[model samples]
Target chain A: MAQNDSNTKDMILSLNSIEVLYDSVLLAIKGVSVEVPRGGMVALLGSNGAGKSTTLKAISGLLKAERGKVSRGEIKFDGKLIGDILPQDRVALGICHVIEGRRVFDHLTPDENLEAAAPISMSRAKIKSEKERMYEYFPRLAERKSAQSGYLSGGEQQMLAIGRALMTQPRLLMLDEPSLGLAPFLVAEIFGIIQRINKEQGLSVLLVEQNAVAALEIVSHGYLIENGRVVMHDTAGALKENSDIQEFYLGGGEGKNFHEIKHYSRRKRWLS
Target chain B: MDWIFLSELTVNGALTGLLYSLVAIGLVLIYKSSAVPNLAQGALTMTGAYVVLAFSHNLGWPLWVAIPLAAVIMFLLGMGIERVALRRLAGRPIVMILMMTMGIDIFLRGTTLAIWGGSSRSVNLGVSYDPFFLGDMLLSRIHIVGAAVAIALFVGFLLFFRTRLGIRLRAISDDYLASWSIGISVERGVGLSWGLASVVAVATGVIWGEVQGVDQSLSVLLLKGLTVAVLGGLDSIVGAIVAGIILGILESVGADFLDPFVGGGSRDLIVAAVLILTVMIRPHGLFGRHDIERV
Candidate 1:
């Protein structure tokens, strides 16, 4: 509610100082405010357990599954206050979340997994066209679509996950750690396809990644979340050039002893 | 030692096994979507039969009207059980959910006992009790009808799993959070599963209630269903059908041939034997976990 109606109207998703509590005890996310404009790509970049995934879960209303709740703040999705909406209804409202790890249905074939991800109310023809569209974007998936998804390569599984998310025809697609464990080439290819989808279909994306360098390359705006707060929110260029980000995240730091000192100093600097 | 009698036993046993498959299918559906072993399936089955009896006998309705009516009631009751009983225990350990199902079993038993009293009741679906000869083998029409119902359910499920909704339900069983992430309502999937489980319970109840008098012993049918579901693999529909047939033949053949030597009842013992043996050789059951978790 901090922003006026006009200010928030164009945004696909806006989180205003939201706080997340796990199991009524652990404070995972502390007053985090993030937004993705309609049809824009944004990245929330952080290391492990930095609340990046938690924020995504908060918006998607998936926190309920984990006994986590957004104890404070309002989440507005597509100009509606959606903080209390159920996760499935949020998907109906066009918020599809591709959670961390390549969590495809391993028992099913890649083709079946895509079909499963389509909205339950979708027509068979629409499912067919959307599947073809997914195959077009991730041709590697189409080649292996008939095979068991569990046997697929890590990169292909990642593509399948993204393809499955797109099957929902979501307006805002939130992906958590899509590039983890993939080769640099595969990550680039998948990220490039995601960028294309965002561009061509006006599908807004909120990508959470530990690979800040690659994420920054594709996304327009980047938020640096450390511990449980957003330390830096800026244009991708500004983030890529930030000294702290360069040293800590982009691997500019050197020496094991020096790395610990820099980590301590960086934490202090970010916190202050 | 008669060839015609032995042939009759074999074919009849397989058809009788279809009834076991009928009951097992409900267990498979619930376990597939929610990963919860519904211990109350037998209780629901007994209750379902009595509900039908009340409608058909007490209310003087026809079998056609009573059967579908009881199914709808059981379906809604199943969903209500999910919402009121199972939903609260969502993120709890599997053992806790398993225990909740047992509590549901006990609660339902008490309710049925209090309502219907201790005496057994007969539910005549008006299916001709007359035996017909197929060539040299004599078979009951009930088993044939059971086979027909089982086949219909099998085909229905086969066509269903191929659909998008069925895929979504299966995905929930695979991973709940992921299913919810993509907008698949894990609640609805689990709730629908409970409803289907109850509907199948009604089907089994009505069929069995017609064959054997509906009584307290009907709850023992859970053990038979459990044996088939476990031997077939808890989550596999095809496994349930195949295992049910195998178990059915073993029971019928054993009761006829083996029971004479061992005094009286050995059917329950045979089911327990299959369960122990299947668990020993294939821990996941015949068709469960089709893919060995790739290292």
Candidate 2:
């Protein structure tokens, strides 16, 4: 417990060598560790099947719902051990996970989606004001406030998903693939809002993204994972300049055909 | 064919449909939140009637006091059922939880039989037995009161769905993980839905008992409610009410005109036929959202 307090004072969330398993048979994440300092934006960058989403789910306590369990290591949130806490209670502790695929309640209208995500402990007045604040941040949401979320375009749904997370007034927001299936302009717009929110509200963020270029552009710190293991961690600028990241992730390598690419090879050079 | 007789039959059928709507709405509440078609609903209805009987007949309590007491007891029983039996099965396969509900239903029925005995009992609400006349058509005051109460409850249900709690319930129904990630306790939400459904069950039982006597067979009324629920779309509250009324009219009118032709008991046959047709044509049922995939 004394050791727990040492690292968490500066970090809003800390994952210490956590391992996640699905169905008690399939290991999805192996010995992963990551952290988000107070009010800092950290990006977890990896391609599909790289365990980026699994790490985020572990922190938000959503692993159980998917038959995925954190089998090893500790997750400390705000200087307290939180691996055993329920996902719903994690929200009360101010950790919100905007899950992958912009999972807005399709049946609910945009405004009602915000209402559903409002923290149970918040007063009605606070909820109302928070809703207004959301509309102010994404004025397009105000235009389609009453439309069913399922009918919204991908970009609008992404905005509503973020707005829903904001409704919880979380201290740490864990977003999984926010820019997936969005237009480039929409990605920039959404990432800009995320940056502004982190800057203005001082909210810590742990963003998991396959789109490393977009994510690295906004995040202060970045970690690159391959096959469930963190191969590299550095400041976003340093990561952008790293040879392996530039060669494989940023598509700047000298490979014209797929076979010559470093990532196409079975072995990862960074890990070796 | 006398038009007056037809009108009376239609009006009577509509009133009976309202009662079916009340029971179906209870089914909808549990089904919507938990995705379990609570098979124990029949036993719950039986238990509710028995609770009222114990308070009113056995304890010699007044009907007014007994009804509320029975409702309170059943509500807690519903919550206890969720917490003790259903909550443990959360995230389990739908079929497994459904089977558990069936087991619960059987257990509750056996308990009812052991405690209440197998005798039919009348519930006297102390209302006047006078028949009200609409022109030449005679209407029972009890039926009128039952219809009024059912409508009032339906209206109350509509208002509930518009409240914050209702929105949360809807959110859980739509996507359980999304609801949990948003900080809504899916387990507690499901438990509350069960409790509220039981309260509806109690109201239904008391009103139903006032018209038909309270008996073990009263549990069979759940089959009619199930029919309404299936025809209306299992998750749609409005669909339940509409389907209930339609079923009532069909049963009443079918019993009147087709019973003799079909050698009696055509009401059940008619309902089964309609249910089959609805399933074949619109599997989502009236007012149910069709799950269309947008590629």
Candidate 3:
């Protein structure tokens, strides 16, 4: 159950043998378990359809929107069973999700997007200062704060997406694919800000990404998933050097032909 | 034709158009937040007028008390409709949701008829039924009040869009899932939108009822509002207002000149033609947001 341990108090998010299904028929996640300590950044790395996004959705209670349900297992946020809470209520509890594809409101200006993200209970002064803090993290957003978000470039839109999440002043931030379709330089820049936010604000994060190298560089721990099940979990440094991850994910290891890499991935030790 | 007569007709048409805009705005608000066409909006309007009648005439309440009370009741009714009927139908196909709204419309109409009887009733808003002169053109006071109130409501909505709650509504309309993930209650937002829209519907009905007696025929006004919404873009408030005015003018001018040549009541025909043409040309409406899909 991963409960009653002395260190469990420090765990910001914990999923114990969680199983997610779509339409009550198709299983998307099968007996997955993971944990994120308070103030620690954890990355979930996987290929497409590996259920990384689904895991984030389940933790944030966003699965109900897509007709997906956690048919089995439980998810806890800050030691509370949050699997049954609504997505909006989850935000009041200081958990915010930056969904994939940077879904900013197209008709609104960047400044307005931040305002919408701010909780209704927050005073105007708090909202304004939080917005200013976000602008400091992404100065490019400051330059385009008044422009309609839909017209912003891809990098700018991604910045707005993260900045919007930051406006909630969350204790735990879950981001899905912040690096998708972004250039390497922009990806590094965004990750740097994420790292700075985590360090300075003592915020916990659960990041899902396909860019393992960039994600691993900032994350404290990393978990590898394939076909909705966790195949490996270790410190970021260990996973970066693991033979299987080196060959299959990092594109490392010497003399590994394409066929050998594919064979190795197919028969991973954890899969058995 | 005399220039004064032409100007009078134009002014009258514009005033009537503003009323249409009032009705269409309610539909646009519901569509924007909930993505439901809200076919029942017209019925809501009819019911609102009847509620006022029940209060003022049957219950012997003053206009001041009855109007505000009726608006409050209609607002709750709107929220109830969203919570009980539309909430269950969330995430359904758009067509199915729209059909449900039609069913609601039928239900409301039948209920109103059963409770209030089918006979027409006159509503007194306490305004003097005197004709005022604008230069040489005679104007009805009711039409003038209708125009003034419609414009006021339109301005109020524009100001609303600038507030924090308005931003939440706009955010939900832009992307439901994104808004939901960021702590906005999408359901509550949609429900509130319905509530606000119903308040507008009630106002529209009261004003409209003062001009034309309240009866089952008032529901036909929904067709006019729908025509305006379709021509202007179903999701655009600005488009609805502008299209309403334009249709109103077209009906006024066409009824006077063109109707004599092509039988009676060419206004409906003209509005229908314009709706079809607008759909064929600019389906997104004059100011409606066009979805840009990125691969």
Candidate 4:
């Protein structure tokens, strides 16, 4: 609430007083505010159950289905009141949410899954060109084009999910928990891909990650979310240098090991 | 049965089985995509038969024009069900959806009987071809053409699932949230699947009407089609076709051999029993995905 006084420009997406709850009992997210400008990456960092996922779902219109109503909030995407928009409409407007769990269509072949994510208006030639671009982005997916996504290894599925999102040609690609259940090498690899996507394609990203340190290292800005609220917001470099953030949020281990350094005592998690 | 008789019966059953598969395939598609068994699938088939009767008999349209027209009408009816009933229950429990379809079945049957006047009726398209004979066996041109059309459709669906649009439909069936986030219109996909199902149902109805004649009991006749879908595999399209043929032959032979021992109306009981056994043995139906992983 105090951070509202410091006005910021260059906002691509703005959430003013976003509050989401699953019934009255589960106050999954509370009065969370965030702003992401076009062509920049911002991380919403928190541990599990810290309402990071809830915030992403709210922005994605997934919360509406789960009875998680936005009791009070205004979500403006590209300066439009997009709070009431449907999930598919949001994608037509170029906001792709790369959810966690790599939930691609397991029964479908990898190529088919990629085609499903492609925009409906794309011509055959454009589809082929997009396919070539995806292959260039992830050579491993190209190798297994005919195989079912169910049989793909964990890392490959993660690559496929991101590749599928990119096929939509989205403006703001919101990634939820990109670093979960990955080896350090793969985590680094994914983060590197995100960096390239933002820099080379000029794609805006609102990345929510439990691996705070790694996420903060790649993004221009960071928000520390705990108990459904944004507790800290600053330049990624400033948050990286903050001692309390470093010890508690980022962990003392290598920048990718926030899962090991998590502490759960400070917030009234059930209440908030 | 002797070897010659057995071989002839097997061929007869197999041809009939293919027709059963055609009828069952649409039910599987609607069930897999919409997760509703659509008991009204039978009613849809009946409606298609009625449409044919209306066009060919009442209006004196050519059979060529009547058949496709009937199918198109049934397709629109399927879309109407999706808009009127299924759309309202999106994201609700699977049971609630099933109950809603049951209500649809009742409404459709009542409306049909009221309009068509609760009486048995027969329709014959004025194709003056003689029945072809093969070694003391009689086969009509309609049966051969019907069987061929069914097989072609089955192959077409196999190819369709490989296409981009089919992949999106399958994706929504697998995970709604994942598909939606990637810009797949779940509502539209489900509606399309229902429309496809109705097309198959209408095709089966036309063929069945041509073969056995149409009646007010035509909806009840779809019970056998449902049996094929359940026995072959609930969600598996190929399974439904296979099961349909298998059941058709089995029921045919059972009626020929075992009906006298069990008394009259034994075929229905046998089909129901076989369906129950298949479901109990493999709850997902044969060839369906056995494991569902949740995280």
Q: Return the top candidate by lDDT.
A: 3
Q: Pick the candidate with the highest TM-score.
A: 3
Once model 3 is optimally superposed onto the true structure by TM-score, how far is the C-alpha of residue A48 displaced, in angstroms? 1.0
Of candidates 4 and 1, the better by TM-score: 1
Summarize candidate 3's per-residue lDDT along B70-110 as a digit string, tens digits: 99999999999889988866666789888988998999899
Interface Cα RMSD, each model:
1.4, 1.2, 1.4, 2.1
Error of 4 at B156 (Å): 2.6
| Each model's lDDT | 0.87, 0.87, 0.88, 0.79
Off by over 4 Å in 4: A1-9, A21-27, A252-272, B58-60, B127-131, B264-266, B292-295
Candidate 1 scores an iRMS of: 1.4
Tell me the spans in candidate 3 whose CA falls farther than 4 Å from its real position.
A1-4, A254-272, B293-295
How close is every model to the real structure, measured as TM-score? Answer: 0.94, 0.94, 0.95, 0.89
lDDT of 1 by residue, B121-221 (tens): 88887789889789989999988898789878878886777777788888888878788888887887899999999999899998888788898778878
Tens-digit lDDT track for model 4 on A12-104? 788887898796567888888888987889999877888988888888887765767777888888878798889889988988898878897
For each candidate, what's the DockQ? Answer: 0.67, 0.72, 0.71, 0.56
TM-score of chain A of each: 0.92, 0.92, 0.93, 0.88
lDDT of 4 by residue, B245-270 (tens): 78867877777687788777777877
Find the candidate with the highest DockQ and give its number: 2
- Report the CAPRI category for model 3: medium
lDDT of 3 by residue, A154-246 (tens): 899999999999888799999999999999999999999999999998999999999898999999999888888887778999989887777
Please give, for residues B205-290, the per-residue lDDT of candidate 2 as tens digits: 88788788787877888788888888889988888888988998998988899987879988889878887888898887888766
